[model samples]
Target chain A: MTDDKDHYIRALFDISPAYDDAPVFQQKVMMGLTLKSWLRQGLVVISGLIGGLYALTQFVRMPEWSLKGGGLYTGSLQMATRRTDATVEAGVEFIDIMARGLADSLFAVGGYVQWMQTPQFFWVSFALCSCILVLYLLNDAQERI
Target chain B: MPQSPGHNSAQDQSDIDLIGRAVTGSHTAFGELVRRHSGALRTHLRRMGAQSSDADDIAQETFMAAFERLSEFRFEGPFIAWLKMIASRRYLKKLKAAQKYLFTDDATLFETPDEAPPPDMRLHDLDSALLQLKPIERVCVTLNFSAGLSHVDVAAETGLPLGTVKSHIKRGLDQLKSALTVPNSSSHPIASSQNGAAGSATPTFMDERR
Candidate 1:
């Protein structure tokens, strides 16, 4: 008899009301997931930008200090303004000199750039970008559906 | 349970497949899951005495939390069961925060006994029948019957003493039987006896002795 009562109660509980708000509920949950995804992606992108900027500054500073012995900043500024001629020939020559100096700096920093391309850094960057891209595509696909 | 409109289209995909997709950041898969189970979960929460708005809020929180921790979910059980567990815990947490105690001798708990809805009104549906029970009793009964949790599991999940959980379930079942079965029906002798034993008083743990 007790078993019967239990069964009856279970049966009663099983009778779910016809809830028609599932679409609305699903929309709310999906909206929540979208918001969370965007927030997470935003954090990742912001952190990556900050880290990349810091690393770039460090890379640029290290090479300048090592190659030029701390005179690169003032020296470049003086060189660029030293030939302030109104003639187009002088301006062209000044730009040519600046471009050559930039090339020299790039060559000086070649070792550091190669180090950044090593397997460890390359793989880490690849994996991070891949994750972000996959997340973005998934979110976009879900939104479209 | 009534399926959402798109439930059929997603029915071809297994829950594990959907979960795998969701884990990889598939919102469409997760949305399908939400569509498939939200009705039953919402109904379960309502049976447990959660107001409609509270049920929706708790259900939303449960799904959001489940999404955040989808990787932690083991594949040993049905996905709906996992969803129900999440929703139940969310509802219980909300209830605990509001009421502080799951079981109490507060007079409000007994108010329904004296002001019992008419028999016809109570028999209108199982939800109405459940509403006749105290909050604790309703939770215990719903967890046991609706969520299909064992007594031990319900006690553990509720953080209530096992004995208290059992008594609440028994009393709750008795009240529900009395409310649901046609009054004075000879075929259901147990229901009739339970009604007599229960009387028109606020249920108390003390009454469990009888």
Candidate 2:
């Protein structure tokens, strides 16, 4: 009885109306595909343009010491090494001051504040923010695609 | 009436070749696939209790998804089966999104009139017969019989309990049999006793593995 019922049901569902709208259906699907492709491509191009514009802005704002070569490069490297040593010293001093107590750490805190105001710090912060923004935009665009 | 350009050429290529081209981003090849399978898929969705407009929408969404995921197709089965699987999943998603609580375990919620008079067999098609069933029952039966999903697969697909899926299938099958079975008519023979034929109404691409 189960087998007979299954057979009858299969045959019944098999009797589908002959639809002549295949061409129209195909056109609709193709149009959807094309539109999605265009949107995805447009997103990628927009993301690339945003990234390019950000890079160009950063390039325009870049310090001459970072972009130049020869004497200025050597001087900048030396200056960067000195600044790194000074930052390390300040960090150690801040930790030591924290270990002692918070009251005597004004000079260390001032040194850290001065370090944060430097051009190198500003460039680093700008680059990090730009990278994060680009990555976020790319991720959003990929999810949309 | 003249056929579209490259229509004959596209038809000559096998589904595998068309899939390969579609994977490489050939809209024409993918369009051929859509042209080939849209009718059957739309019909399957309609049998699964989707309105004709909704069926077409779901079919279009399925094809679009298939195109995006063409590379994931392993070529281990018929392309039509893969397409149907996507369509079934899409339809289920739409059903769930539209009706948040459609697939409950309550049998009483899906009860049909068992003692109702049989319809005029001449005018009674499967679509109308399917309407006699509850939405969940129609979905379960169509997934099992039309979309070639097993009871467990249907349960997994619909997120319903196994017992509920089984009951739905059983009740849906009973209702369909009562509605469609011709009294003392021998015109319809059991087409094929195998799982492949029993799984699908129109046996275009029978994936026995399903």
Candidate 3:
């Protein structure tokens, strides 16, 4: 009789609001699956690009520190004056002042950049990007389990 | 052998068969599985004290989560049971998230027993009765009786101690019995489809009890 009561209660409790799947539900799931795959690929590409940029910044020849010698003075003067209606003398003065300030700021950080002279900076950048990519993939993989 | 009331013993594709196809990247197979089980899952959520719309939202999350991990399914039991397990977890997470905002006394909620319902008053009345139960009691009762999970399974899913689950079920059943059995002259909280037509009629749960 207890079994009967339990069974009867189960039947009564099983009564629920009837629902049918809206086509939109299926559409949403499929769209989500697509978005998830695309995001995975996109993250990989973004990490690779970041890694490439880091490598380039480390290996490529950056501008030398001389305000007048490195292309900074000529480049800024031409850029500010050639494409504008500004007087050449005024443009050269403006460019020279701006270049000097920028050079001073860069020189302020010269010690840190100098310390990064070895391949350590490249490896650090590589490691950071790789760690980010691995963590992302691991999160996705864990979700599957 | 007599099958359970809602068992779809004669369906063309068994859940295992459908799951097999789903594992091979068949969206149609998965969609079919969702269509097959979503109603029961939604109902289970509703029984657990979720408002109608919230239940549907949780059902959506449950299905999406289940699909992502479809390959992990071992097919050792009924697929509906597995779906229920996932839905229960989602519901618990939702309850945890909402704990900061809502406060209601289960004792106060059930204080007004409301008039006994008509003998034939079905779906809406059942929902109304369930609404009177405390959220945890409702979950325990629905999981054990409605969803057919064992006490251990309910405990495992709900993170409630086994004794607590059993106590909730016992107390819940008693309240349900009274709510459905005693046909008092008091006003019913939920508007019935019959509108007090079956005045002398036995309540649905009492009738089921006999």
Per lDDT, the best of the predicted structures is: 1
TM-score head-to-head 2 vs 3, winner: 2
* lDDT minimum window of 10 residues, candidate 1 chain B: B190-199
- Whole-model lDDT, candidate 3? 0.63
How far off is model 1, as Cα RMSD? 11.3
Candidate that would win on TM-score: 2
List interface RMSDs for the candidates, in order. 12.2, 8.0, 11.1
Order of the predicted models by TM-score, top scorer first: 2, 1, 3
**Ranking of all candidate structures by their lDDT, best first:** 1, 2, 3
List model 3 lDDT by residue over B34-145, tens digit each: 6667666766777777766677677777777787788888887777777777777777766766772222434554454466655654332555667667767888888886
Candidate 1 pairs with clashing backbones: none
DockQ list for all candidates: 0.19, 0.16, 0.11
The better candidate by DockQ, 2 or 3, is 2
Report the backbone clash tally of model 1.
0
Q: Report how closely model 3 matches the true complex, as a DockQ value.
A: 0.11
TM-score of each: 0.65, 0.67, 0.62
Model 1 DockQ (Cα-based): 0.19
lDDT of 2 by residue, B1-210 (tens): 998768777877888888988899888888878876776677788777776677888889889888988998999787766777888887787788787456665668766676664556434456657878888888889888777788899999999889988988898777776776544444564332211213344332112112
lDDT of each: 0.71, 0.69, 0.63
Q: Name the lDDT of candidate 2.
A: 0.69
